[model samples]
Target: MVRRRFPVLLLHIFSMFAGTAGNTQEILYPFGPEHRDLETPKMDDGSSAEITLSISFVYFNIPYRTVYVNNNGVISFNVQVSQFTPEAFPLSDSRSFIAPLWADVHNGIRGDVYYRESTEPELLEKATQDVRKYFKNMPAFTATWVFITTWHQVTFYGGSQTTPVRFKCILLLNLA
Candidate 1:
């Protein structure tokens, strides 16, 4: 009985891999709020005053769609947040001091991320269809992984106009 159970367990684990681990690609979106300064009460004795600074921060994961084809192919799809308008999207609610200070894209693609504040819904639909078509033409994909990156500010003091924020994304591909 013990020997039989061992083989069953091994088969279960191996079967799980059948759907994951294949060609994968990642897209990233970068945005952030500004830095701000805070004031603190002075500790009596007429010496020096204290100050506390803070900023707002936000972070969330994007959803992805995984399609399993009849011929052992898999395709993953998701919106590219990197294309959102820097000014509109990931917008901050406050002004006195910005959160984030600065935002950037790391990993996946180098350089700066692009945004489309005025991008139309029709454009988005077209983009999605394009991606779907691209994958459909490919021979087959065993599995895929999709990832999204975001930045948020929490607290700040002032004089932080040029701080660098870091974001990252990576994709792994596997052959069956």
Candidate 2:
């Protein structure tokens, strides 16, 4: 009886912990507007009318990994930023908004990157090479505004069998 109860207790605890994971949320920050035009115009009474026009642009980021499972059960790597939320971040400061930004990966404000590796000894080398090559020449990172943004839930897709995996969300700021 004692032995049987121990496994049941452990199972209950594991299930409870897993259930809490669904409570977390991921938020995406979209960019803001760009100041377009600002000029002083003549009023109907021949007085100077100040007309200040401001236009803003927002950019969003969507990153996803695509895996191609071959006949031998190898997962090919394809990591990329699916889309940029706001096309551009505009400001009147005469500075480039191309600077690096930060994001939360684990449902936090600071985003992180998701990385994983399998335990299969034969596949270990291939997985390492794939990840290294993927990171070697990644696309340019853009600033993602946290406010006035949208978010998409992260879900697992592809691969009928769920293998051991790890994930990370990285906050990338524009360096330039």
Candidate 3:
């Protein structure tokens, strides 16, 4: 039995090393037909705009929110000012309107905070246009906008009119 086991072990060892020499070259240079050389493509002279906008309203009090993403990769937001009122007291005259909302954009590297508030309709439109322009010129892949909404005056009923609410708008661009 011992002699037979010794011969089997030697045969297995010899067979293992017998194929090692032939497989060495295959392991070193693995250039098979399936492996093809790939090259990076050059950038195009004219580029088209392809942008996606994701807007999330953190507070539930906000009723109407609109987000627009144009072909130039610009993003604009239009939130109804009157929707900030509490649902319980919708017809309350004492409720104060939204004064103006401020926005700041950060693109990982740099950040810019716009001090102007969107008090009037025209000003709000202009602010949206300005935000769109800012995003259009941004060369980064990802950007975030922080919107701070404040009320002009506290409501007499004392419901949800004291503190400021924040909304976030994220822009993701697909360069492919």
Top TM-score: which candidate number?
A: 1
Error of 2 at 36 (Å): 30
lDDT of each: 0.21, 0.21, 0.24
For each candidate in turn, the TM-score is 0.17, 0.15, 0.15
Q: How many backbone clashes does candidate 3 have?
A: 0
Residues 1-176, candidate 3: write the lDDT tens digits.
Answer: 23110000000011122343233322121111232311111111111122122333222244223432211111233421223223442335433222222222111122111111123344334334544556465333222232221111111222233322222222221221
For all predictions, the C-alpha RMSD in Å is 21.7, 24.2, 30.7
> What's model 2's lDDT at 83?
23
Query: What lDDT would candidate 1 get against the real structure?
Result: 0.21
Off-target runs (Cα >4 Å) in candidate 2 are: 1-19, 27-166
**Superposition-based RMSD of candidate 3 using all C-alpha atoms, in angstroms:** 30.7
